[model samples]
Target: MGHPAEVEVLSKALSGIGVDEKSLVSILTQSHHEHKRTIKRGCSQFFVEDERHFERWNDDAIKTLKAEFKRFKALHFMK
Candidate 1:
């Protein structure tokens, strides 16, 4: 549950109908590298389904886009 509050905020930002880009940027940009790594690791615990599950999204294009962006941010910033 690494950084549960941060993880919850991130989960909220990525869940539901739309993304909270402001929240995402605020968290990712302000967090330390180690914190980002914790968040990245937490994502696996939270989103246990599968990364490719995002591609199966057909009901909402925005959701798919949001999910893909989430993946991108995780990969790009977690370094």
Candidate 2:
């Protein structure tokens, strides 16, 4: 299947209050392992740009946000 902008999609998924966990799941799980690696690396831009958005959130959201990414890595990156 044709892949759209991997970074862009990931950026959107990671944007807004808290992480878009569902969107992350839909995108990461559908992509190949190599593509997942690409997504993992490309996540920097999203964090840097959206850092302010996440900053207002409480520590719990911060922890949950990390957990969300870890979930993505576990499901998509781990064999």
Candidate 3:
């Protein structure tokens, strides 16, 4: 899924008003662990820990969310 063409498909799926759920699900469900790892690694290169959406959250809530997201990244990323 890290291939240029696959990235293009995912970009399209994510950039629209509504996601193309079927395409996204098909790609993910068919992927092997290594393929999913490739996808994860590729994604981290572009992923940002944006906090703008959480501006309204209390500091503790925001901290918790960020901590959880960090843990998720560490657990799933192919280090």
Candidate 4:
């Protein structure tokens, strides 16, 4: 629960019908690695009960978007 507001925003963005890539990028790119780790931890702790529950939150579109974002981030960080 480092940045509660950010965790909330991310939860909202990731929970719904569409993925808010802008907000995700904004918070993630602006955050330090420690902050990102905290946010990730907070998300699982607060928003998601467990891995199975979290998987239920993802539809096909969200899954694809998530994978794409991961790829993009990896490439961006590599540069």
Candidate 5:
């Protein structure tokens, strides 16, 4: 399980990268640890402690992540 605050941070970060809330929720609920790890890694890679870091990611990176997130959502939903 993840802390609510951490989850909120992840949600905001995901949205910043173009993921929808429903997909975010599904990912968080179904594969909590993997999702948490991905978010943490993304945050660290982008130095994302808040919205500002989200804003700073290059457009290409954001686009790549959006694609990766879509794949994650599909895999998660299949389970």
Candidate 6:
């Protein structure tokens, strides 16, 4: 079980990415242990770290978002 403060911080960070609190909770709770571990590691590494680390994480996240958007648009036109 995660600490309450950690959970709250994670929820707020996820919200910044446009994820709703309920869905975030559901995803975190229902995911595999490996997934949870990875997320916990990433949250500590990216969110709680210094500003440089956060900026780097944010930049990579934006790149991933762009790639996903491109893939989504490509699939949208498929018959």
lDDT of each: 0.70, 0.64, 0.59, 0.70, 0.60, 0.56
Candidate 2 structure lDDT = 0.64
- Give the winner by lDDT: 1 or 5: 1
* Candidate 2 TM-score, true structure as reference: 0.46
- In candidate 2, residue 12 scores what lDDT? 76
Those runs of model 3 whose alpha carbons end farther than 4 Å from true positions after fitting are: 45-79
TM-score of 4: 0.56
In model 1, state the lDDT of residue 46: 37
Candidate 2 lDDT over residue span 1-79, tens digit each? 3245767766776666546777677887788878776775666543333355642334554576798777767877766
lDDT string, candidate 6, 1-79, tens digits: 4445555656574544443445455667776777676667646543344555553344565565466556656766784
**Candidate 5 runs further than 4 Å off:** 1-55
**Residues 12-68 of candidate 5: C-alpha lDDT, one tens digit per residue:** 656554556565566567666665766655454544344654435456656767797
Report the C-alpha lDDT of model 4 over 1-79, residue by residue, as the tens digit: 2589998888776665656778877898899889988997766633333565543332554566677678667877999
Locate the minimum summed-lDDT window of 10 residues in model 1. Answer: 54-63
lDDT of 3 by residue, 1-79 (tens): 3576666676566443545656667877888888876775554434444567422324553464456556656766956
Q: Which stretches of candidate 2 lie over 4 Å from their true place?
A: 1-4, 45-79
How do all the candidates rank in terms of lDDT, highest first? 1, 4, 2, 5, 3, 6
Question: If both were scored by lDDT, which would come out higher, candidate 2 or candidate 3?
Answer: 2
Clashing pairs in model 4, backbone N/Cα/C closer than 3 A:
none
Model 3 Cα shift for residue 53 (angstroms):
21
- CA-only RMSD, every prediction: 9.4, 9.3, 12.3, 6.9, 9.9, 10.4
Which of the two, 4 or 6, has more lDDT? Answer: 4
Report the number of the highest-TM-score candidate. Answer: 4
Global CA lDDT of candidate 3, please?
0.59
